[model samples]
Target: MYSKVVMDHFKTPRNVGEMKDADGMGEVGNPVCGDMMNIYIKVEDDHIKDISFLTFGCGAAIAVSSMLTDIAKGKTIEEAKKITNKSVAEALEGLPKNKLHCSNLGADALQLAIKDYEDRKAGKVRPPARPEDRHEHTHGESCKCPYCNGDVNAGLEFCSHCGKEMNDSH
Candidate 1:
């Protein structure tokens, strides 16, 4: 079950591809984790001139990426940085309570891209390495689903409680 806005974005997401000429880029999580997002930004004079994203995730992640770019485009860096998980969830008219953390990444991804741009400008740091991708994790009986935080079989591919796919990231 999803809101119309959520479904609309999931069915036809905006800003869904990579921007090779981007001024900055940010990535969240590893592919082995099974829900990763990358954000690219082209900024001009402290304003966000353009934005795009590549999200290898579920419907909620796609919608969050689309809505995030829509909100950040044309805003000043300071303004865009203020965009948060709570605000993006609200922009979607709200996500299922269990899916709220899915919204936490939009602004974080953007802010990291901005920080990367700044770091590059100062030559103080190279873009950070992506987190190490690890898998074959064996969860204990107490482990919970990363998506819904619901109880799940440690070996299951899908959460019995939420129907969300289970991954090493969980």
Candidate 2:
């Protein structure tokens, strides 16, 4: 079952496409569920001037992607970073319990986009992909996220859990 807000967003998803000149881009997927999301952002003077997304998922995923963009537009990067899966679901009047991962992926995608933008601005190289979940690998690295004091790997661009940049090298 879906809430009215969820249904509305599902049927009329907003900002539902790729951006050609995005300042930042993020992509995330759930292999088990076969859901994927890509978020694009355009920043101007430290503010999110625009945002968009492309999602290969269910109605909940599409709806969350749309809502995530709406929540980030016109906000500063820091403010946008504060957006979370919980807030996204709340914005939609709450997603089905099982569909909450849709909101998680949406928020993660946006955070990753911002990390990409910051990395580019600071002239940092992207990390090589690893097979394991970054969230899991972080625990073995024995370091904490500077922003949230949560576990993170040395090479990660951002904390998998809190979305905090893992280091200041960038």
Candidate 3:
């Protein structure tokens, strides 16, 4: 069952539209669940001046996206980048076990949006759409440890560089 906060957010999602003049945008999808999310952000003086999203997903996914924008807006870029899947889920007072993945979609989309904003500010070319293209490692081959951003081999239980347990949350 969904939490009251979840239901409230789903019934009246916030920042629920696209921004044509957004400074950065990110899109992500979960093929298995058929959930897709697009996050748009506008920055000023290194802060998230505005944020919005368009989510094609279940109620939980919609709620997560709504909460994510609320959490990110007005925060500095560095602060917003720290918003994680666990944080979003906690903000909603927690989601059903089966719907936990929805939080990941929201956080990942936000991270990608922030990265796009940074890249644009640095005058760097946008990376390709593929996950592997955005990351240094090949998809399913390896990934950066969420704790330390160290290269971690796929399927590892703990990050070799950070020694942190890799749980379902990460």
Candidate 4:
């Protein structure tokens, strides 16, 4: 029941591996659901020369990771950081409602990778202690409302702080 794009990515996922000398790296996870993804990037002169991903997850996770790498490559670090879950899902045509979280996994992975690269350039942070990576954070943390930075509980009807109606499908 997978979409055509998802099927294609699953069949021949692109940029699926590690970059031993990656300029940056990022990982994200939904430990409760056991989906984890690590993304790596290679940079040259502030431009993304390559992007790759390794995922311990399902079909959707693989597809999202592949799509994310493809989209992030050739983009500058700043440009890559702007990539979002909505854009990843759009690039894949569409994912099943339940699989939307996979897109978040991809976005987070990219953001982490970009952050790593930036940190390296600025000498602000170091790489992982181990190459065995996973998603950086767990679930139940991203459902917050952006407008007011308020805690939006799962399945809430409105933003408790801003009185804004929450989209049913978000």
lDDT of each: 0.82, 0.86, 0.90, 0.85
Query: Once model 4 is optimally superposed onto the true structure by TM-score, how far is the C-alpha of residue 156 displaced, in angstroms?
Result: 26
Candidate 4 residue-wise lDDT at 163: 82
The TM-scores, one per candidate, come to 0.76, 0.74, 0.74, 0.73
Q: Supply candidate 3's per-residue lDDT for 115.
A: 89
Once fitted onto the true fold, the runs of candidate 3 whose alpha carbons sit more than 4 angstroms away are 30-32, 128-170
Identify the candidate with maximal TM-score. Answer: 1
lDDT of 2 by residue, 1-170 (tens): 98998889889988988899999999898544558899999999999999999998998999999889999999999999999999999999988888998899999999999999999899998787676643333234567666777766665688988886554432
Q: For candidate 3, list the clashing residue pairs, or say none.
A: none
User: Whose lDDT is greatest here?
Assistant: 3
Residue 62 CA error for candidate 2 (Å)?
0.4
Off by over 4 Å in 2: 128-170
lDDT of 4 at 47: 88
How well does candidate 4 score on lDDT at residue 93? 93
lDDT of 2: 0.86
Q: How does model 3 fare in lDDT? A: 0.90
Candidates sorted on lDDT, descending: 3, 2, 4, 1
